[model samples]
Target: MRVRIKGDVLCTLLLVISLSTLLYSLLRPTAKQDIAPVKNTKRLKNPPRTAASKKYYDSKVTGKVKLLSEDHHADVDSEDVKPTVPPVKTQSPFDFQQYLSSKDHRNFSLLINQPNKCTKPSGESFLLIAVKSIVEDFDRRESVRKTWGKEGLVNGVRVRRVFLLGIPKNKTTVSLWESLMQQESHYYKDILLWDFLDTFFNLTLKEIHFLSWAEMFCNDVKFIFKGDADVFVNVENLIHFLQNQNASEDLFVGDIINHAKPIRSKKSKYYIPETMYGLGIYPAYAGGGGFLMSGVTMTKLAEACKEVELFPIDDVFLGMCLQRINLKPVLHEGFKTFGITRPSAAPHLQTFDPCFYKDLMVVHSLKAAEIWLMWNLLHSQQPPCSQKQRIKKPFHWKKKKTKQAINAVTRLQVN
Candidate 1:
């Protein structure tokens, strides 16, 4: 009985211990706690704070923002920014108002009345005397045409119309042309006009007047004598010289300078900028001191003037026009252009002294009175006006035979 009780107690004790352990486990688990997942430890290993990762991020951001270049990504501070160029404006095709409003039209009537002030006359006519001024050193024309005009021959070719050119500043007086017109009208054919100022000729205001006359009276005239007033032209000789040459449509004349810059001096009356004209060299006949283009050339030049902007200097402007047409200037030595200082002694002198009237065809820069005197000197035996003043002597009667002899002598002298 004692052994049985001891075994039972041991069994009871084992049961109680098992029960207590079970109850403790069940009660404790009733208060539940949740646990989160473990973070990526590999991400921490390659930290975003590192320089390589930061640079990669920056590059990726830049690539993604490229489309925002217009607003934010443009290089505004760059020195190589292209400049904005303005479009070129074309001129109106035909602006008559512009013609009337141009600086040239300011004194049209005044200029017409004073043509010789800036221009010269063309061929001599029954009622007109052509005139010009030939400035050789400044003009750069040949000195051989003086003889050609007088000898009535040029390079085995004869030309019609007188092409007188070049007159220095001193030779041009205000009323000289009018005075010449009035005095020589009896002998000429018609006075076609030309001048340095003929914007076509690149002349001054006074010279333009001369050139305008040709344009003005082109309808009323035929043929031209574009010569210098300063020159001593033998009208008869010039008429004879040009009679044989065939009338040519392309009578491009003068000692043509190939390329020349139109002058643009601020102080000068003639000023032109490069933007105004595109051509660098004159393609047309230049050196107006003594050149002869056809009346058609004048027409073409006038037409071209409408299309081309006026260059302050005339010859170069004309050359530009001629170049456009692909025509060239024909160099003629017979169109005596400039200086022959000692023409009397020099070979092929284009200009000579008034005293050398017999040999001189065109002596540029002469006075009206001097021209008249020289003409008289060439054609007549005595001077027109005595250089010295002589007091009149009291008249005295002489014997009839002696008077008759004196009268005969006086008549011979007068004739």
Candidate 2:
């Protein structure tokens, strides 16, 4: 009976121990449960995420995208993302003078074949007139041919006119124009053709080529009248003037500008940069509109030009050459480069007048019609205006008084 009682006690003790272990296990925290509560707390702290927000968050966490700030992207639609613009390319400054200096002078070639014109000329030819004309200036060339360019005896001296030209720019019209030029040459026999482009800058090349031609062909020619086609040249007066001047005098005469400064404004037609001519002041040069040079002076000037670098401005370049050779251009009042001014008060407003241009060797900026008119008026037997009626101050006279003076003069001359 005692042994049965002890076994019951031990069974009771084993049941109590089992119950205690079960209670301990039920109260203890597990790793999974602790992690689940932490996740729940984190979810509560952050707002409930939409699909886009979730995707964005995932991308942000993975560092897969660079998104604009909330403020920037707020107004922008998701589909309308702004693209970045590429930077612009900057060009280097163009150095025209340097480019000209770098070129080989020996590469220049003559296109036209007028080998015998300058060579076959008689020893009596006193002046070889070279009018620097462009290929496209057919009208101007015609005007010149008919007017001042008509070759004949002037003041008992033989004068020859030759138009210097370069290649045309228009490729399509080249053949047609060339054919016309050939016909013109055949009929007139007065065109000097070179292969280079006829640009304002390349006028120096024309001068150089003409000089070279003169050196080879008409070396014994007494004088060369280098002028433009637009200018109205008083060939009669010019010849007379040349005859009067000492032939031995190294004559280079025209309207000379002594203290002209280089134009710096880029927008100007005469714009010259420091790169082209670094010098502040330009040497005195005859207004390139028209100038006379003795054969000796011409040869020396050509030699001087050969040693100097090519300058774009034809007049300025010639001046530089003259400076190098220690030759100075003689300034003359008869050479009117700025054209003759008309009297403001005169009844008949004319841009040109026979009386005003009677004594002047050159009057620039004359049109085809005006040139024709002047040619006719000048050649007429009766003088248009008398010496007493002629207006003296062409440049500086007051408008009203000058006009009154001109009217009085005109009436007096008529009476």
Candidate 3:
């Protein structure tokens, strides 16, 4: 009976312990169980940040916002920004308005001059050959010097030479051109350079200035032959022509153009606007190609030129000066200032015949080679004009020239 009672007690204690364990497992709070999910939710809502990653995210957001404002946006601080549009330019091919606007800008200084040019170191200059020239026409000037314009005794009379010039129109090679002129002047002593830009319209200035120079200094000079560089002058023929004429008498002679009007076409290089000149007909003027005037007449021209208004066309301006002094210019047939015309009846005849040039005083628009060839042909005693010859055609042979410029400067004594 005692053993049974102890067994019951042990079974009851084991039962009580099992029931308490089951109750504890069923009644515990759920708060501690929800902790893992709460932490995961907080982590998903926000990611970890670094400097590079934050910059990348902000750049993406700003790109979307800036798309609407792109055209209106201008960064004032950025030097790279500039207007791509170019400035408006004039519509006309030539700026005639600007040229007309600056017409009063005349009276330029003499940059280079020859004060002692008329001193007549050789002899009282019986005839003065004044050629209008520009800087790049070195070959033309040399050809003139080598041929008719050579300063020395021609027909036993003193013949002096000079060139009228101005600053080169080509500005790019101005320095080189200027340097060459110094050497040329030192050697030739024939250049008359002025500060005015060398141009067709400014030839009037050259005309007046030369007349002033001659009037001031060349009172003793008997005759003057003024012409273009391109013209081939028969100086001997000219001297022979002057021998019979008196220097004291007024004599201005050339191929005179009777009735001419200013060219109104702006496209033409000789354009003259109505604002510049209003006259319907230009005054009767000698061709600028070549002309001969006595020293006395030249002096009168110098005085008359100062009294008249400046005109763009040099030849016409000279006519105005002549008119101012109540003087008339005569026409000379020997001066072929315009290019030669082949006889209409004899169409086959070549205009380059050497015989034709023998009697002419001045022939305009001949090449340097033609001048040289004609000079040689005439001096060599070629046949008369009536005979047709093989040399009648233009001389198309290789132009004879030295590899370097012929140093004629060395041959002539330094004046």
Candidate 4:
């Protein structure tokens, strides 16, 4: 009986112990159940930016592309595109198209040829006279042909003559010009026509083409006298002048302009735009009215012209060619290419004094009739003047012009 009682008490003790252990386990803290406040790691590759960072990023990147996955992370404008800059354009005052056209098309087709001009021919001419003429200037050409340009022996020396021309630029009369020119060519046998527009600026074409023609045909000519149709040439005086000089050596003589600046006025006939010629002063060049060059000098000019570029002014272009070959063109008092300025001191002097002209080689700006009249008067000689008064002395500034020309040439060479 006492044993049973002790068992019951033990059973009660076991139940109590089991119930206590259960309560203790239910109330105890676990590792997963530990809830406490802590800091976030924030280790993202492209982390969220603050207000200062967002402003800085938007201003710096011009074309920032965001991926679709970044929609949840950051904010930016969809209009964030690259800005473009407009180009700056400058307008030039000069006509570039016309200039390029002239520069590109220099070599023109030949319309008429005087192949036998130097052969058959004055074979080897003592003087090859080339007059710059036009189709409409029939009277002028006739005057030149009758007077100083007469072919054959002059002063016992052979001379040949040719008139350089280009197609008439007047569209209204272009058709009629062809037939008239052909007739003139057949009659005179002295027309050297090229298929270029006969304009003032295109005179450069006449210059280079004539040089090439001279080289091909009149290779043996002793001398060449190039002049305008209006100028009066004393053939006898010219022949006398050439007799003293050797044609084998270089000789170029005319009324040379020294230290001349380009005329920039648009209305002037000799206007030179800054785009055409940028230089301040032009090279020394002979007057286009008349000039004399030796056959050897012509050959040299042809070669030099091939190397140097064509300039608008024919006279200046030739001067550039001479500069290319280091050749010097001498200025002479006998050639009054600018026309005879009546002496301010001697207003009594006649403009057409045959006695005074006897000492001169060339005189410019004479009318067609004046040239004819001068030729007859000089040959017949009715007017009389003292030998001292008739003398064509050099101007006082002649030496000064020569020195300035030399200095200008030196400056060009240095440049």
Best by lDDT: 4
Give model 4's clash tally: 0
Over 1-415, each residue of candidate 1 has an lDDT whose tens digit, in order, gives: 9999999999999999999999989877554322111122333345435454445446532112222234332644332122211333433322334433564542233311333311233332211223443332212122222222232223333233322232234555434654454343223322233333333223433334444555664423323545554555565554454454444454555555655555545333434445554555445455655455555555555555555555445556566667665668776544445534543434543332333345433445554555555665656654322332421332234435778888999999999
Output the lDDT of residue 352, model 1.
29
Off-target runs (Cα >4 Å) in candidate 3 are 1-106, 381-415
Clashing pairs in 2: 345-403
Q: Write candidate 4's Cα lDDT for 249-364 as tens digits.
A: 99999999988999886545677778778999988899999999999999999888888877778999998998888888999999999898887656666668777687998998
Off by over 4 Å in 2: 1-98, 118-121, 173-175, 342-351, 386-415
Sort by lDDT, top down from the best: 4, 3, 2, 1
Taking all chains together, each candidate's TM-score versus the true structure is 0.40, 0.68, 0.69, 0.69
Candidates 1 and 2, the one with greater TM-score: 2
lDDT of 2 by residue, 276-369 (tens): 6888999998888899999889889878878888877789889988999899899888898877766666536555668767888988888888
In model 4, which residue pairs have backbone atoms overlapping below 3 Å? none
- Model 3 clash tally, residue pairs: 0
State how far residue 339 of model 2 sits from its true place (Å): 1.6
